[model samples]
Target: MRRIAIIGCGGSGKTTIGRQLADQIGVPITHLDAVYYDDRWNRMDPDKFAALQEELVAADTWVIDGNYASTLPIRLKRADTVVFLDLPAMTCLWGIAQRGWKYRGGQHDSSGVYDRITWGFIKYVWGYRRDMAPRVRSLIAEYAQHADVRIVTSRRAARKMLTELKAAVH
Candidate 1:
C-alpha cells in the first residue's frame, strides 16, 4: 500500500509502528499527536489543526498514527490500508504507563512522534479502556466500511505484523 494509517487506544504503539512502517516504505510520516498537541501540552485550535491536517494528509504517501474521528475520516479516505493496534485492555494500560513514564520528563514530539512520557498520564492510559475500547471499535467499524483495516488484537499479532511487513519489504 502507498499510504498506511496506524490507530489504537492510547499507548497502543501507533507512533512506534508508524515510524517503522514509514522507514520500511521509504516515505515521510505524519505523527498526528505532534500536530494535535502544542509544546506546553496545549492543543492546537480546531481550525488550525484541521488546516494542518489538510496539508499533511494531502501527501502522495504517508504513514500516519492517531485517532481523531473528526480528522480520521479524511485520512482514512486517502489511506490504502490501516493497522490497528488492538491489544488487550491490560496490555494497553501497561503500555500507556510505560510510555507516560518515558515522556513526562520533557520529551520531544515532531513528525507525529511523542518522544516523552509522564507518570500522571500513565494512570489515565492505564485505565479507561472500558470506555475507550467501544469508541475505538466503533470508529474502526465505521471507517472500515470503505477503508482496508486490520486489527492487531494481541502482542503476538503486533510481532507478526512486524515480521510480515519485513517480509513484504524484502
Candidate 2:
C-alpha cells in the first residue's frame, strides 16, 4: 500500500501492528503521537501538529500510527488503506494491562511514546475513549466508503487484518 493509517483506542495495538506491517512492507513509518506529545505529555500546538502531519504524509509510501483524528483527517483522506482496531473497552483494558506493565518496565513503543500505562492512566484513557471512540468509528465508517478500511475487533481476527496488509494492493 502506498499510504496506510492505523486508527484505534489506547492499548489497541495500533502502533505495534502498524510498525510490523510497515517493516514487512519496507516503508517509512511515523507515529503521530511522538510528533504531537512533548516531554511532559503536553500536546504541541494544533497548527504545528497539522503542519508536521501534512508534511509527513506527503511521502510516497508510509504507515502512520495513531488516532488523533483532528490533526489526522488530511492523512486519512490521502490514505489508500485504513486499519481500525475495534476491540471493545474491556478488551482494550486487558490489552492495556498487559502492555502497560511492560511499558512501565521500560518497554518503548514503535510510535516512540513511552509505555506508561499505569492503572490511573489506563482508567483515564478508557474514560477518554468513550468520548473519542465514536468519532474514530464514524471516521472509519466514513472513510470505508471512499477507501479500504479493514477493522480487527477480536484477538482471533487480529491476523486477518495483517494478512490484508500483506496482500499486495491490486
Candidate 3:
C-alpha cells in the first residue's frame, strides 16, 4: 500500500508498524504525535494541525500513524490502506509500561520529548477499546470504505499481517 493510515490506542504499536510498513514499502513515515506536539509537549493549534495533515496526506506516498479522531477524516480520505491495531487492553497496557520503562528518562521516537505516563493516561488506554474503537470503526466505514482495512486484534496477528504485506510488496 502506498498511502497508509495507522490508528490505535496509545501504546498499541502503531508507530512500530507504521515504520516497518513505510520502510518495507519505500515511503516516508509521519508520526502524527510529532506533528501535533512539540519537544516541550505544547500542542499545535487545531486548525493548523488539520491543515498540516491535509498537506501531509496530499503527498504521493506516506505512512501516517496516529489516532487523533478529530482530524482522522483528513487521512482516512486519502489512505489506500488503513491498519487498526485492535489489540487487547492488557496487551496495550503492558506496551505502555514497557515503553515507559524503555524511554523513562528520554524522548520517544514517535511521541514528543518525554514519555509521561499518568494515571489518567493508563485509564484511557485501559478503556480505549470501549471508548474509542466505535468512533474509529465508524469513521473508517464512512471515509475509508474504499481502502484495504485491516483490524489487527493481537500482536501475533500484527506480525503475520506485516509478514504478508512484506511478501506482497516484494
Candidate 4:
C-alpha cells in the first residue's frame, strides 16, 4: 500500500508490524512516538507535533505507526490502508513486559521515547479493550470509510497478514 497507518493501544505491536511492512514495501516508516517525544522523553509542543504529522502525511508514501488519537484523522484521511492490532489485554501486557525487559536502561529501537514500563502503562494495557477500543473504532469508522481496514486480533494473525502482504508486494 502507498500510504499506511498502523494504529492500536500501547504494546499492541504497531511498531513491529509497521517496520516489517515498510521494509517489505520499500517505504519509509514514521513512529509517532519519535515525532512527539524527544530523545530525553520530553513531550513536544502539541502544535509542533501536529504540524510535523501534517508534513509527514504530505509525502507520497509512508507507514505511520502510533495511537495518537488526536491526530489520527490526519493520517487516516491520507491513508490507503489502516491496520489495527486489536490484541487481547493480557497479550498486550505480556508484550509490554517483554519490551521493557529488552529495552531496560535504554530507548526502544522503534522510537525515541524511553522504554520504561510503569504501573500506569500496565494499567493502560490492561484496560485498553474496555477504555480505548470503542473510541478508536469510532474514529476509524468516521474517518477511514474509504480506506482498506484490517483488524488483526492476535500475534499469529498479524504475522500471517504481514507475510501475505510481503508475498503480494514481491
Candidate 3 local lDDT, 9-49, one digit each (tens): 88899988998999998987888888888877789999999
Task: State the lDDT of candidate 4 residue by residue for 17-121, as single tens digits.
Answer: 998888877887888887787777788898888888999999998999999888898999999889999999988888887877888847876456566567887
Q: In each prediction, how many residue pairs overlap at the backbone (N, C-alpha, C within less than 3 A)?
A: 8, 0, 0, 0
Candidate scoring better on lDDT of 1 and 3: 3
State the local distance difference test value for candidate 1: 0.73
Q: Which ranges of candidate 1 are over 4 A from the true structure?
A: 100-104, 108-128
lDDT tens digits, residue span 1-170, model 2: 77888888877888778887788778867877777886567879999888888888888888998888786577787888888887777888888777767777343645467655567766756774577777877776665566677778877787776776677642
Scored by lDDT, model 3 comes in at 0.90
Winner of 1 and 3 under TM-score: 3
The candidate scoring highest on TM-score is 3
Could you give candidate 1's per-residue lDDT for residues 16-113 as a string of tens digits? 78888888889977777777886666888988887877777788888888877677766776777788787776887777667667666445445535
The C-alpha local distance difference test score for the whole of candidate 2 amounts to 0.76
Residue pairs with backbone atoms closer than 3 Å in model 3 (clashes)? none
Tell me, what's the RMSD of every candidate? 2.8, 2.5, 1.4, 1.4
Worst 10 residues of 4 by lDDT: 109-118
Error of 3 at 13 (Å): 0.4
TM-score of model number 1: 0.81
lDDT of 3 at 45: 100
